[model samples]
Target: MTSASVPLSGPRFQTEPAELYRELRRDHGAVVPVSLDGDIPAWLVLGYRELHQVTGDPVLFSRDPDLWNQWPGIPDDWPMLPVIGRKQSSILYTVGERHRVRAAMISDALEAVDPFELRGHAEKFADELIDAVSGKGEADLIGDYAALLPVRVLATLYGFTDEQGPGLVTALNDMLNRTADALAGKQHLAASMGQLLADRKVTPGNDVVSRMLATALALEAEGSGSGFTDEEIVQDLVVMFAAGHQPTADWMGNSLRLMLTDDRFAASLFGGRNSVAEAMNEVLWEATPSQNLVGRWASRDTQLGGRRIRTGDLLILGLQGANSDPQVRTDGSALTGGNSAHFSFGHGAHRCPFPAQEIAEIIARTGIEVVLDRLPDIDLAVPAESLPWRPSPWLRSLTELPVHFAPTPPLEATSA
Candidate 1:
């Protein structure tokens, strides 16, 4: 890290990040020293090989943001507090054997989700969202469809009523965008989760929270006897809801954007489902929803990508940068499907759990399929170059994905 560190600024990081990432790699090699909003320093790991090394070794690259050496300088009202905070009890900062048990609890609860039921919920929500704007003959898919779908399914799966989904979505968006309302949003979400937990304790249901609450009681059977508390479960739920919603929503929007604009997918968009999966996979590699992750700290002084990282230094996981690392994509033609090696999901034990990944996939893919089924003639409402993306260093999402389609009738609401 040096005085010449990149300022991590500009709209280019959002609108056209690929070129920016390329330049960063060219000038600074794999791990570029960078400055955040307040000139706070960190490393952005851009090399596929280096990112693999960083994430693969949990001991060397720690997840505890408290390990950050710059923390003492961070203020009480810092904007990045939500992204990097102290005293957060979520599983994200949990370490060692405790983290392993927590991971198992999460995995077991998610794995228990009946695939048929999960898909059924996804399809239900997708159809309902599509039904909203179908009659208009045109819609901003990002707002009308993509952004509204995932969290609804997730909320329902977590025992929240259908009516509660919209409010949760609003709160989550505010929280993730890191705006003035962020703390309020976080408080709102926490309140909602608290309410749900209280309700489930009184009378459990067939949902993720109910399962987690029940399973947390059986920690001895789950590899630990100490177990966890209800507040801990609430924190985990908040993390799960935040992680699953926005990225999956963006995955749907990004994939649909790709299908609508790219000629390779245009031919099949209206006729068949053959190209849907390929387009989704391509988004994972090229325009991954999670562009970067608020990330690992150096457990000790170490050298990565030829840069000396002092103990407790922050290292943000540059997922998109790593995926597009020139060394890995030497051919540069871009991968389609059947190649799941992308860092879109993090690596090693601390990675997004497989079941959670599957849930995101189901929500995203099902939303795309529903749109194609309902709006067969969907096309970009504006020129491809005019499409706007949300400005953020962490998430890659469109501000709006406007599209026009043949007028269709809205479907009547029905029980799933």
Candidate 2:
């Protein structure tokens, strides 16, 4: 079948794509043809083993979008441009020496962050957020809680003020949604980051932004071509902001949904039969927030999962599809404690930095725990099955998570 016949990103996949993935796997084995934006052809890797092979073999399958042979024919205003288009400063779009240099700088800056301290801050933020909504009988968790926690924590870590949090959220959301004014949002975000970088340069602090600036300067002093400019620093910060907050927010929402809807899983956690970590792992395995990853281009003509691949052809890694492969694990159990085999955060040299995972988990777990503790009687305001999902190829986000809980007095009359 041709890619034009398949719809990979739309309302159908948004609400329930698992059945479609299963049918595709059955008909095409591990690798299947799919279309992005309805006409852009690409291969979707669905097998657990096959995804590993492709991500691990950078020589055969490159992460550089510059290698995309179809770029010349595609228009600049393509709907997927924000995702698959190449950016000279983005580590996500680079390969080889460029990737290695930028990745190291980011890794070093992240390693400097103390996980324990970060978790403590996240917990405090969680408590404050809960306090704000505790007095209300109901809330939209996606908006009031899950959505704000991550961005707040990230802003604090990046040395941004509380006043700036809302704009950051708006900019990041617009860019992710690829809205009509996404370009304007990007420009606004860039201007904000540039100003922040300037402020940090004048007055350094213990935040990630300061650390990255230091590293960039050091690389420049060493005469390394990988040295970062102010513009480049701003780009990396944008990446961190988008990558850090969006997935963590979705993960928090997904985990809470599981606890509220799945009796077996919730019982296991509340009955002391399983830990929160176990529940989180299950969410990662079954309903990964970032359902698909973009832009892994073919370095040369090669075969993958028994399918012919030409040089420059794009390959999209179906993360959720691979984790749910029936051949990998049967019965679809959610209580499979602490299994780290899933590709939720990806694998190999290009795997998400360890610091990102640690911070995201701490924020999500702490945020969820605070809500459950403060509002022990929380339940879905509407039937779980009727809940709608945002129609995006990358994220598995609920449009809203309406929930009800017992009314209590706010800890203080302040906005979260």
Candidate 3:
């Protein structure tokens, strides 16, 4: 399968891909052959159970890009190089002992964040963003609100000042989108993180970076050998921004779109018949933020979901497809009732570490709820079909979410 023969990215799958997914499941079971950029063939895992099996057994299906069969032969100018290239030191690219060490460091750093305070902060950001457009009675929610909230909140948590927020957000967007500017965006991100780390070393503060640096120093003092290097710290910061900022932004956009389009959900949520939490779960089950996770390379020859996966074969988990599997639930109602058996946040060691009660869910819910609270009458400016989405295989983000709402007065104070 070559790139010219088939389309594997999210844009091709955006037009009601359920039928395609169902057909793939029927013809190929859970795992199907698909082409990524440059016609790179990979296994697309679409079954919920199969995702668990593969991600759970990381030894068989490794996260290391070095194990990919085409890594060596792939040219430097390959379009997918920015995403598939193994040039960074992210825990997302590691496995086994190395993965454990990095995961521990990240977990420890996140421990300092108070979930309740984080929720308040997220809400505050949401309100300020909304206020920027609320008085106009119309705004592009994606640009004016959804896209700004998460990055701003994350920047603050990472100890980035207001001046650095826009640059960080731009770099994150370019890097995650894998555009022509991806390499430049990566360089910008590295330089910014390097400067931040240097400053923290000299004068540490109570932010995620400072916490991580302190932890790395303590671990080095114990001669653990697992201590984080400067490069590793930078990589981890990139991962955090990539993982926390964009995905959360996508979730906000997807959830808002769902709430506006789905009559059942829109009525219930806006009418106060259903909670934001319930609506969020429903949206997550239906339109997951991360549609396909970062590809996992097969470490050795193995059979998965009745498909032959050779050593070095790339496996891309179809997160949204798996969550929509008929075997999971008949409809979104089950999701609203708290049957969150979706692979949206994934599973196994690579599962998102943000706990359900805290970080991820709280941030997303608060972001949405605050908007609804500020602009109760907000509605789509155009038909749902007119809205555009980001064209990437890994995420379900909107290009822009234009919305209109009743003009309202801004709050007296913007501080959280």
Candidate 4:
């Protein structure tokens, strides 16, 4: 069949993106043709093996921003990504070694966040959420609980008041949703956070931002070759907030939605025997956040998957496809096991660092067993088919998930 004739089905599963990717691998194999706006031609790599080979070899599929700048289809004025001297993907554009130096400076701050401590925080939040939903007997878990929780945690850590976290999330979502509009939303949020960081610098508080700023200042004092500029630091702040909050929230929401449908998986996870690792792998495999292609431009003439790619060719790494490859799935089952090697987080040097660990705990701790223990009878208030799903290429989230359950009892009075 011609490339255009390849059937493009919508996302697979009630909550998994892997099945959709598996179909792509079965139909297209290594490289699939894509036609973007204006008939721009590109090749999407749909095999896990191929994506690994390309991402690991940065020399072949360079991360340099100039390639994106030179991409043919992007409009001269469009802002799908913010414009700096280089591409938004460029480390320098975000903060380069300065970012690394800042990260190092705050290493102590981050290290202070013991997983046990974070677990306490998450459990408290989850408990309160369960209590809230219990009374209604039905809750839109994604809206009523899941999405709000992580961002609140992140905001508190970052020195933002709990009230501000949701606003920041809404702003970031707006930017990401309007990505095709040339990132106007990102620019707007950048301006707002830039102001916030400057205020924090002058009137420092005991929050994550203050700690990071202290780290930045110490790095500057050491005469390091790499230190973040004020602008770069602010940009990195925006990145941290966005990167930290969204995917995990989406993963939790999706995982909960999926488990509500499958009783066996729910029983094992919430029963607490399964370590957090098992829950994480399964949820990440099931949700597959980085479901869209990672865009790269050919640095030079190269042959891949037996196809010759000339200089300036765009190569989209099919993360979703690789994660769902039948070869990657154990016995072709959706159950997370030895063969489940999905790339919900992009592979290699740039894989998501913090959220992977933190979110895994949230999912592991807030499993079917946990939910059932606290809020049994929590079934879909409406048919799964009635829920609205977000349409972004990179990730998936339910716009809403209404669920019915028992009301939580009122908290008893306690002696101080």
The candidate with the higher TM-score, 1 or 3, is 1
> Candidate 1: deviation at residue 164, Å?
2.7
Which window of ten consecutive residues has the lowest lDDT sum in model 4?
A: 83-92
Q: TM-scores of the models, in the given order?
A: 0.95, 0.93, 0.91, 0.80
RMSD in angstroms between candidate 3 and the native structure over all alpha carbons: 3.0
Model 3's alpha-carbon lDDT is 0.78
TM-score of structure candidate 1: 0.95
The parts of candidate 3 lying over 4 Å away from their true place are 1-6, 10-12, 177-184, 268-274, 330-334, 355-357, 413-416
**Ranking of models by TM-score:** 1, 2, 3, 4
List model 1 lDDT by residue over 190-308, tens digit each: 99999998899899999999999887877745664658888899999999998889889999999999999999998767677888999999999999998988899999999999999
Predicted model with the maximum lDDT: 1
Clashing pairs in 2: none
Cα lDDT of all candidates, in order? 0.88, 0.81, 0.78, 0.61
Q: Mind giving the per-residue lDDT tens digits that candidate 4 earns over 1-416?
A: 13552322244533455555555555656777664444556777877787888777766776554665345556665433331224553243333344344545544555546466566666666666666666667777777676667756665666766556666666766664554543665776677667767878999886667776777787788886565567766776677666666677677776676666555555543444453345556666655555564466777888877667778777777776766666666575666654445677676545455444454455345533345577755677887667777755456677788887767663331111
Candidate 2 per-residue C-alpha lDDT over 134-203 given as tens digits, one digit per residue, 9 for 90 to 100: 8878988888888778978888888898789878777777776677878887888888889989999999
Candidate ordering by lDDT (highest first): 1, 2, 3, 4
TM-score leader: 1
